[model samples]
Target: MTTDTIITARGLTKTFTVRKAVVEAVTDLDLDVQRGELVAFLGPNGAGKSTSLRMLTTLLPPTSGTATVVGHDIARDPAGVRRRIGYIGQGTSAGHNQRVRDELLSQGAFYGMGRRAAATRADELLESLDLAPLATRKVLGLSGGQKRRLDIALGLIHSPELLFLDEPSTGLDPQSRANLWQHILDLRREHGTTIFVTTHFLEEADLFAERVLVMDHGRMIADDTAGNLKTTLAGDVITLGFASEADARAAAARAGGTAAGSSLSLTVDHGELVLPRLLRELDSVTSATLRQPTLDDVFLALTGRSLREDAATSKEEINA
Candidate 1:
């Protein structure tokens, strides 16, 4: 591992046996994350997103393979790894009865910070995360957004070099999600902290992460920038509608597009550049629309299923 590499893993695998059947939760997972990079790890449910995180954070042991986190071997020096990294999981970590500031201080103490330093750090986090107003408030009294912020504060109480967040904004409303993300961005900008996050919100990953890693069926499937992934895998989409199905079919044949009823859809390298040429070449185009491909479209192209649909279905299954 290089000096600037904050995380490195090779052939990491995790397996479980249920009903006398072996199930691989993560397999041959190789990854490297450089310092100060915000990486988004994405996949549908049952895709090993959480499993990979658990292994790297030393919360769960990998069935095979090796990983080094924050310059410490995860399996051989879990305490060293844990001390240098902070993890905020999907669930809340604060105690219901403890005051918010108190919880932060407690976490610092748990990491062996001196009383004065812990108090100072706790106050700093309360101000930075906008939790100062709720410092004396009970954990259960804060709203979902406030509680999530407090969770982040607790994670950062020890000033770790790397932070791992698993679905940090899962249940927030749109406004709250936006607020939380702004704080996260500010942290990365100000602290130069490396962030490895897994989120169900596709737009968040596309908008914020420098690099995106896609996993499915316990394996790494894709790794690239969001724009590159969309461009390379899904491409831009051009839809042209005709008055008659025959006209659409003719246009489809001429442009190598797909026709459904009276509409022809074509995926191209650049829709804006191709649309004008296509219009000049084909006649009887009643309507035309060009759109850039989204991360969901990339997911559809890769897994043969929509990530949004899969996430919804998984949530329903869990609730059932």
Candidate 2:
């Protein structure tokens, strides 16, 4: 690992033996996370995102390969990794019965902090996370957003340099999600904290994450800044209307539609199908609209399915 590298994984693979067969959560993975980078793990549900995160955090042992997180080997330096990183999972962990401020102070005490320091840190986090006004209320009595803020504060109580958040905005409302991301950005900017976060929201990755890693079916499909990925698209997806598929193809051919079929149409990878390009290529074309490609478009192009379908699939599955 290099000096500036904070997390390094080599051929990481994970599998579970539920009964007679093996379920591979992650397969032959390699990852390099530089210090202080907010890397977003972008994938559909059960795409080994949470599993990979859990393994790296030393919460679960990997089936194969090695990782060094925060300059410590995962296999041999689990304790060191634990000491250097803070993990906030999907479920709410703080006791619902206890007052929020008390819970934060107790977490600090668990980290061996003095009472005065713990109190000070609790108050500081309360203010930072917008929890100061509700500091004395029991977590159960708090709203979903407030509890989530409390959870984040608890995770940061020890001031760990690396923070792992798994679906931080999973069930949050739009306003709460916005609040959570604001604090996340602030944490990274103010403290230079390295963040490794996983989320199913493509918009979240597009807007907030410094780098987006697109994963599908347990394999990485695309990894880059969202803009570059859009630029890489085939020269504008041209959807044209015609009396028939052949007419559409004929029109597309005039406008660089090498693979045009029917009104469905086609274009180069990450191509910008703008009004200018359309007008230059196909004057015969009648109505056309320009649309900016999104991370969802990237996901669909790679996974062959919309993200909504993936989310809906996991939600609709019946229990065993």
> Could you give candidate 1's per-residue lDDT for residues 48-135 as a string of tens digits?
8888998999999999999999999999999999889999998898999999999998999999999999999999999988899999
lDDT of 2 at 26: 82
Error of 1 at 96 (Å): 1.4
How well does candidate 2 match the true structure, expressed as C-alpha RMSD?
Answer: 3.3
User: Model 1: clashing residue pairs?
Assistant: none
What TM-score would every model get versus the actual structure?
0.93, 0.88
Q: Give the TM-score of candidate 1.
A: 0.93
Query: Candidate 2's residue-wise lDDT over 135-181, tens digit each?
Result: 88888898898889998999999999899999899999999999999
List ranges where model 1 is wrong by over 4 Å: 1-3, 280-283, 315-320
**Candidate 2, lDDT over the whole model:** 0.81
Query: Model-by-model lDDT, in order?
Result: 0.90, 0.81
Off by over 4 Å in 2: 1-3, 233-235, 240-253, 258-274, 280-285, 315-320
Give model 1's clash tally.
0
